[model samples]
Target: MSDEPLVRTVRPGVRVGVDVGSARVGVAASDPTATFAHPVRTLARDEQHGTDLTELVTLVEELAAVEVVVGLPLLLSGQEGEAARIARDYAVALAARVGTVTVRLVDERLTTVDAHRRLRDSGVPGRGQRKVVDQAAAVLILQTALDTEARSGKPPGEPVTTGGRRKKERRR
Candidate 1:
């Protein structure tokens, strides 16, 4: 049995969040210090799943992300379904492909609604907003994971935090 750590050491670097949908893949990445999540871009689905995954892996690597948190689409009843299963499979595949980074699956409930609300409140045109809703949802998912890790006294992935500068806790 291998004794490798579940969560990689929290380096002073960027982390990423992803909102994966059937048609679109959204990306959000944090600053190197893991202090802020910035909406990256939404990639439209390619004809092949492998191509899409490759593109996503390239994007994450391009950002120099240390960790990745993928939003798991759970049903309103908090149960896993086909969508959740697919997400889990994708996450595992991504983790393997990335090799050096940590990946996490975070419950994604009401994230779409929240994203829509945010866009509307920000006065984004409906048509233009559609292109980025997934990205916004990804930001929400990443922010929530970061907050949960902070509040639970846990580092992302392994549920433990090393001694370091703690930031003000916030919820999404």
Candidate 2:
């Protein structure tokens, strides 16, 4: 028999992952037990009016998500670029809107690339992959976060607590 250990749920509540792109934002949700992450839907980015954030708030309340993991697109060398800055700002705004729910930023170094490779390997043609690639990437990001949390026995990623000690941890 295989020797892989079964992954146990660390914090028993739903978690959501978000992949914010130029035009579309991909969303994913974990089960109540946080054992599996699955794609929910793609939303058009509304940076001008923040309609996307409103929808996200509704989605979070509806799913009763305990945490929201926003993908921070860090470079391979671990430097923050424009994309990372955008993600950080978005996470802050999301945290402001979500009230007591936690919003965290996890480094998303190669999630998009890995998602593309996985889709191609799974026989999903290139033409159809673009439509759903963001969602797939969100799934990868959330699954990785969940696994890390379970293994480390702590919540994964930097908690985006604006005006709090955890937010100050961003410097570290």
Candidate 3:
């Protein structure tokens, strides 16, 4: 919290955003200029068969993304919970499979809730939202990352190295 804002130097390239949920995985991608993010797709969580991760890895490769930003849902108290743990695991698995592309986790406290609100505000119905809420949330997550990197002159979140989860107190 400084009076002077940090000027971040962000690389210009395509970045992918992921929102990992218990039932579905949302995917989003930024433009090559790293300007805007839009929904890519939603994959059914297939932990049993590992299909979700497979598809995600393929998608990232296809997009030739420079970075992959995964949403880490932290509790309002700035603490980790089951959902956070799940996201971390997903990121670890993704990192192992994604080759050189980097995976970073950004705090996503209420992106899903906000996405729902945005969808509703945009006239998307409750029932219809179930199919795309995750994607909307992914968009918010990626846009937030892009904005953070541009404003703070730093990557938006902690990078997920093959070693494992990066930090515990991200908010502080």
Task: Assess each prediction's global lDDT (C-alpha) against the native.
Answer: 0.76, 0.89, 0.91
lDDT of 1 by residue, 22-120 (tens): 888888998876767889988886646577778888987898776788888899998989988877777777776775666778888889889999999
Displacement of residue 9 (Cα, Å) in model 2 is 5.6
Provide the global lDDT of candidate 1 against the true structure: 0.76
- Candidate 2 regions exceeding 4 Å error are 1-9, 164-172
The worst-scoring run of ten residues by lDDT in candidate 2 lies at 163-172
lDDT by residue for model 2 (99-121), tens = 78888999899899999999999
Ranked by lDDT, the better of candidates 2 and 3 is: 3
- Per-residue accuracy of model 3 over 48-164 as CA lDDT, tens digit each: 999999999999989989889999999999999999999989998998888777789999999999999999999999999999999999999999999999887777888886764
Q: How accurate is candidate 2 locally (lDDT)?
A: 0.89
TM-score of each candidate structure, all chains considered together? 0.80, 0.90, 0.90
RMSD after CA superposition, every candidate: 10.4, 4.2, 4.8
What is the TM-score (0 to 1) of candidate 1?
0.80
Extract clashing residue pairs from model 1.
Answer: 13-32, 155-160
The list of candidate 1 runs beyond 4 A from truth reads: 1-11, 47-49, 156-172
